[model samples]
Target: MTTTLAAGPAPVVARPGPDIASRRRRARTRERTAQWLFLVPAIAYVLVFFGYPIVKNFVMGSQDYTVRTFVSGEAPWVGLDNYVEVVTSSIFRTSVVNTALFTVGSIVGQFVIGLLFALFFKRRFPLGNVLRSLLLLPWLLPMIAGTAVWKWILDQDGGVLNEALRAVGLVDAPVHWLTSPDVALVAVVIVNVWVGIPFNMTLLYSGLQNIPEELYEAGALDGATGVKAFWHITWPNLRPVVSVVLVLGVIYTLKVLDIILGLTGGGPAGATETLATDSYRRSFQEFSFGTGAAVSNILIVVSLLFAVVYLRANRRAVDE
Candidate 1:
């Protein structure tokens, strides 16, 4: 056996260049970095403002917290007493009902009126743009100021409403519109409708405008006219918009605070009270943070429920 074979050539070393796995890992890191870079500002804002407040509010709500004692950092633990009080209290339940009332009334009234406007303004007419612009006045005005204007307009003695009523001999005496729960609730609903109409009108009008004119013409040729044509052509096409506006109207009007606050402050018997107003008073005025949080959570639940319903409706519409 001969001899020592020449030593095998020194083992060759592989280059350190990236293999498939390493390359994939590097790419993933780059993508992750890009995602975080894009999200940093939003994350920071939420953490600093919304997130911190929400968490702190939750923590403080569990304690017997108040401004004076909070600074000393010895806030007493109150357990679920706050929650007990909130649910058991008569005020929260009344507010829930009032909110529901306001939302339902406003949405129905606004839809009827907004559909009218959408139909009216659908076609090009003289000064149509001007009319639409003027229609936006209620929506463009600041919420508090706008509601305040309505408040004054509904004032029992000096309101323009009463004045107009008397001028037209519609009433025998001035009505205490805001001082009575029954009337005040109705008045607030009216104000909400006024504010919401322009929004729904504009949105529905845009949706209506998107429909192909040929569809209407075809329906007309088939002897469908007026209400029949609208039922067959317009309503079907505008269904999505209608659903969206109705759902959005429900959500927005449900959380409505300025309108109720400016008009009624939930006065006369909590008849005009809503979850939003109740939450505000509980947290700010009554120093019942837990109760306020509970109300807010309920409000959020209601909104989310409606949102889910709307989305289901939209999906069904799409599937059809």
Candidate 2:
């Protein structure tokens, strides 16, 4: 005990070796440099394309920029005139209603069809792979080609749909699917649903795949089976994926341009003119860029609202 003298204050620990610290600093610098090198192309692309266009659109919308009101020099600002005109105008009002109908209809139809196909594919039956690929064929086709094919099927006089109806004696006359204002919207929605179904199926199928079989086994132990298991486990698991798919579908359906332009050109007295088509018609067709841009901005606002809601839902899902 007497020999165990108290130790003196501990020697000041040497700082890290200079070479080791230097090597770490160099390694960190290299890593940072590599990260920036990888990000350079992406940063450049965003600034050039997305950033520039967004800024330009806002700037262009601000000025009296229509072909009618345009001048080479700085444009005179017309405060709220474009907004007022678009809101008050009759065609614009009609366009708003049609857009609403088309959006809701497409979402409903696409959702139903997509859900069915997704469920069908989840079972992994024989030929499921072949069927899955074939199902995606419509989605893969060029927009122009897909529209052309639908045009053939929907041709009032000589279309295959009419021929089949006649052969089956389902109706007396070949239904003028596209020409009639009443049915034209529905027809376009049908095409959209059919085309969009594959995407929904694919996304949902993947989500379904991620559901652990252990959950189902656990449920079975509790006497849960079939639809009950699906509701309790499968649905909870897929809800996150479903939210994303539907929100994206809403956005995609809202911007449905080529299909409407290709099929009907918003014809039969503007029955099929969605907000997107209306924007195109006003801007390009009539050279009213300001008004078109306003409509576009409105669409963007709507999309943003949906995005916000979807993001909130996703955050909640992750927390759960």
Candidate 3:
């Protein structure tokens, strides 16, 4: 027992030395730095492109920014006066009404026609892909060019459309599509619908492709074929996609400017003056930067509302 001799002063526990610990700490710091480095470009891009403009727009909206401001280098603070004036103006009412009509008409026309096209193409056929690709030409063409062509086609005199109508005896005289205030908005809507259909068809077709064929086969066994199968199986499966398409269509249609501007230039009598065109008219045409920014801010707010709705619906779809 005495020969145990205090167990040789206890075994020495080998803890990390200062050099090793320091190396570990440095490695962790470097890892964190690398992660931040990877995020730097994205963060900077967002700040420069999105953040600054939003802030600048908000600030300009609060100030009396105009041509004078550019010359004097000072935008006087006018608080909500610009917004008040814009909202109280008579054209504001007209613009709002026209915007609603344009958006609704475009969305309805695009979705119904696009869905029909998608369903049709879902069936096997020769040159189906070729025809679908041809449909995309409208979507692919430059907006200005497309609208320019549309203008020629809709011209009151010497236009192909009126020529065809006359050939078929559909009407005795030209429709004055872009000239008459009553019909200008309708003509603009038709052009927009034509442009938007391909987009909707592509998205909806992708969604249709994702649906499992087994479900349809199983549905047929239960007497769910054709419209019955579509209504019971396809529609329920496609509801999420439909919601996304409708919301996106509404949002895009709300902000449409180029087509309307190129086709009607805010129309024969402001018949097609939407908030987008009105904002452009104010900022550049009238040199009322404050009012234009105000109108744009209103539009941004409306868009945000739809975006929020989209987010909620998407989340709901995911949960289901």
Candidate 4:
């Protein structure tokens, strides 16, 4: 009864040696390398396509690059002379004014109309989806084709718009939509707004969709309904989305060339000329590549400033 089994020795767990630890470190390094390898294609694509063009533009902006430069194979370095000429030119003032008016008018029209449409479509109705899909036609159509059709519609004579106005007694004669310098800028802005409306509507609709229904219901219970509710509840929630839409609208409107070019060709005596068209004219039409590059570089700087502002605002929104 007093006999007991002898105690067995403690089993020693093997500690990782230097070799095993080194092998583990190597495996981790390999895993990280594999992860970064997946990004190579994207990085290379950006560097080749975006980086090269931007760098070339910057170089061209600093030199006297032109048609003759092509023949001579010598682009004499001019430093900021191109920029100075661009800024001091008489056309520069007109382009700046037109650009500002075009941008502001287009954004305001697009945002207002798009917001109205989005609010309208947000309500459940018969064939709402169909109508919403139809609204995207402007955005989906080819820019050149759309602007061409718009040109015909806005023509001074034998145009649908003039005919409609005359038929309705709104105008006694054809209004020179595209031919008059005074109205050409307005016409271009109208076309741009038409093309841009669907984009704003789509983005704003998505943002509206994300707002919680409970917040609205709660607001209603407190007697904040309709406009008041929208102001106090909906607007506060939608401000971040609004900021994004506005910034993007400004950026896109700033560089719009096709709409203006197709509709006005930067004329009726350069009435609708913007920075974009001016740059194109300087480089291709006039063959002053340096000046064109300089104008474009200025545009790039403006766009970058807006982009910076957008990033900061977005970060703030996220933090809140």
**Tens digit per residue, CA lDDT, model 2, 111-204:** 7778878878888689989988999998899999999999999999999999999999998998989999889988898888888888888898
TM-scores for the candidates: 0.83, 0.91, 0.88, 0.91
| lDDT at 309, model 3 | 79
Better of 1 and 4 by lDDT: 4
Residue by residue across 120-152, what tens digits does model 1's lDDT show?
999899999999999999999999889878878
C-alpha lDDT of all candidate models, in order: 0.86, 0.86, 0.92, 0.93
Which residue pairs in model 2 clash with each other?
Answer: none
lDDT of 3 by residue, 1-320 (tens): 35654555777899999999999999999999999999999999999999999889888888999989878999999999999999999899999999999998999999999999999999989999999999999999999999999999999999999999999999998899999999999999999999999999999999999999999989888999999988988888888888889888888998899998898899788989999999999999999998999999998899889879777977786687
Runs of candidate 4 exceeding 4 Å displacement: 1-15, 310-320
Q: What ranking emerges by lDDT with the best candidate at the front?
A: 4, 3, 2, 1
Model 1, runs deviating above 4 Å: 1-36, 43-63, 74-80
Q: Model 4: how far is 68 from its true place, Å?
A: 2.5
Determine which window of 10 residues in candidate 4 has minimal summed lDDT. 309-318
